[model samples]
Target: MILETRGIGKRFGSVLALRDVSMGVRAGEVTCVLGDNGAGKSTLIKILAGVHQHDAGTLLVDGREVRLTGPRDALDRGIATVYQDLAMIPLMSVWRNFFLGSEPRKGLAFDVARARRVAREELKAMGIDIRDVDQPVGTLSGGERQSVAIARAVHFGARVLILDEPTSALGVKQAGVVLRYIARARDRGLGVVFITHNPHHAYPVGDRFLLLNRGAGMGEYGKADITPQELTSLMSGGAELEELAHELRRE
Candidate 1:
């Protein structure tokens, strides 16, 4: 396993955000974390991304216990998270956005040429083809922007990629494009943690599923262990859904 969380948990004042949520991601596999709103998915991602520390649990990198105090800590350990907002400046060029905080420098000066060359090469390595690295980030399509973010994370040497609701706002075609890049990332031998509520989106690319309900674990199952229909039904609260159907039945 590249990343492992043992009995991970978190709390906020009177509410319990997570409990005994254990998960693991290995190279060349996508672990999809599925849940609806307030299901503690965000909290769990924060923990894994080093945005928040687990109140209780063990975070292990390469099977060795480690503490993630902040985002830098996680990044140093080869973990990178791409949130829904993507963190790219609209007016900035693609290469600049790619190296925003960690820009390549030449003797205390920003190496604009080097950054552009490296960015183009890195994106090409991920099979992403954008017309120009000099174009402003806002000029790229939504799917393209998402792909750039993924490529940036991969280029930065992130052994584990944590994506939060990456496909939520995209159209079917755009979502399909992003999913392709996700598969590409997995193929590159990186552990991928894909978080989303859409069963359709998760089903196609996920190797393992960790279902969350009201801040608790429903269960973890391999792709071969459960059907997509079963996963969707369970995610929608099967018994509760049955009750709801009966309640809404016309006489």
Candidate 2:
């Protein structure tokens, strides 16, 4: 396993947001973290990404226990997180966004040529078909933007990529496009922690699934051990969903 959490728990003053949650992401595999709103999905990923510290249990990277100081600490250890907001300037060119903040320097000047070339090459390598790296990022489709972010993280040598709700705002076609790039990243040997509430989106590419409900572990299973239908049935209020469906059915 490249990243693993054992009995991880977190608290926010009077609220215990997460408890006894354990999950792991292996190299070249996708670990899908599924949950509804307020399921502690955010809290768990925040802990993993070093946005928040865990109050209990252990976080392990490469088989060693760690207490991450912050997001910078996680990044230095090859753990890169791409939050839902993506941290990109919409008006900036794709290449500029790719090398933002970490731009290469050539004698006190930004290496514009090197940045553009590397961005194009890396996107091509990831099988992303962006028309031009010089185009503004805001003009690209949502899926295209997500792909570029994934490619950037991979290019920067991320051993483990934690993506938070990457597909939530996308339509079916666009969501599928993002899922393809996610699989491409997994193929390149990055342990991907894909956080989402949709079982339909996750079942296709996930090697392992961790279901969260009300800040606790619903269950964790390898793909072979669980079916997509079963997964959807395990979410918070899953059983209640069936009852609601019955009431709405036409006779």
Candidate 3:
């Protein structure tokens, strides 16, 4: 396994956001975290990304206990998270954004040309099509930006990629594009944690499913253990759906 959390819990003063949440991600597989709003999904990802200190839990990387103090700590351990915001500077060119804060240095100068070439090559290698690496990041479509972010994470040696709502704002076609990059990331042998509310999006690529409701885990299921319809029903409230169906029936 690439990453694991045992009995992870987070609290905000008196309220518990998560309780005893244990999940694992393995190389070459995608673990989809499906939850409704306020279901502790964000809290879990934040803990994994080191954005928040867990109130209680054991975090393991490669089966060894480790303390993730902050985002840098996570990155140092080869765990990278691409948030919903995409994190690309809008006015900056793609290549510039790609090398932001970690630019290639050639004799005390940023290697601008090298960065552009490398950014272009890396995207191409990942099967991402970009008209030019010098285009401002804002000019790229949402899916393209997400793909660029994913490519950046992989190029930087991310062993585990935690994505937060990657396809939430995307249209069907754009979502499809991002989904392809996700599969590509998994194919390259990186363990992936995909957090989303979209069942259709998760069902196709996920190898394992984790469902959360109101800051608690319902359960985790393998792909073979649950169908997409079943997963959706669970997410939408199985009993609630049945009640609504019964209420809507006309005699």
What TM-score does each of the candidates earn? 0.95, 0.95, 0.95
In model 1, the worst 10-residue window by lDDT is: 242-251
The residue pairs found clashing in candidate 1 are: none
RMSD of every candidate to native, in Å, equals 1.9, 2.8, 2.1
TM-score of 3: 0.95
- Model 1 Cα displacement at 57 (Å)? 2.5
- Please give the CA lDDT of all the candidate structures: 0.94, 0.93, 0.93
The sequence of per-residue lDDT tens digits that candidate 1 reaches over residues 158-250 is 999999999999999999999999999999999999999999999999999999988888889999999999989988888698888898995
Give the per-residue lDDT of model 2 (tens digit) for 129-206: 999999999999988999999999999999999999999999999999999999999999999999999899999999
CA lDDT, candidate 1, residue 67: 79
The better-scoring model by TM-score among 2 and 3 is 3
Q: After superposition, how far is residue 35 of candidate 1 from its true place, in Å?
A: 0.3
As a TM-score, model 2 comes out at 0.95
- The positional error of residue 86 in candidate 3, measured at the CA in angstroms, is 1.4
Per-residue lDDT of 84 in model 3: 92
Best candidate according to lDDT: 1
Model 2 superposed RMSD (Cα): 2.8
lDDT of 3 by residue, 134-237 (tens): 89999999999999999999999999999999999999999999999999999999999999999999999999999988887788899999998899889989
Model 2 per-residue lDDT at 99: 96
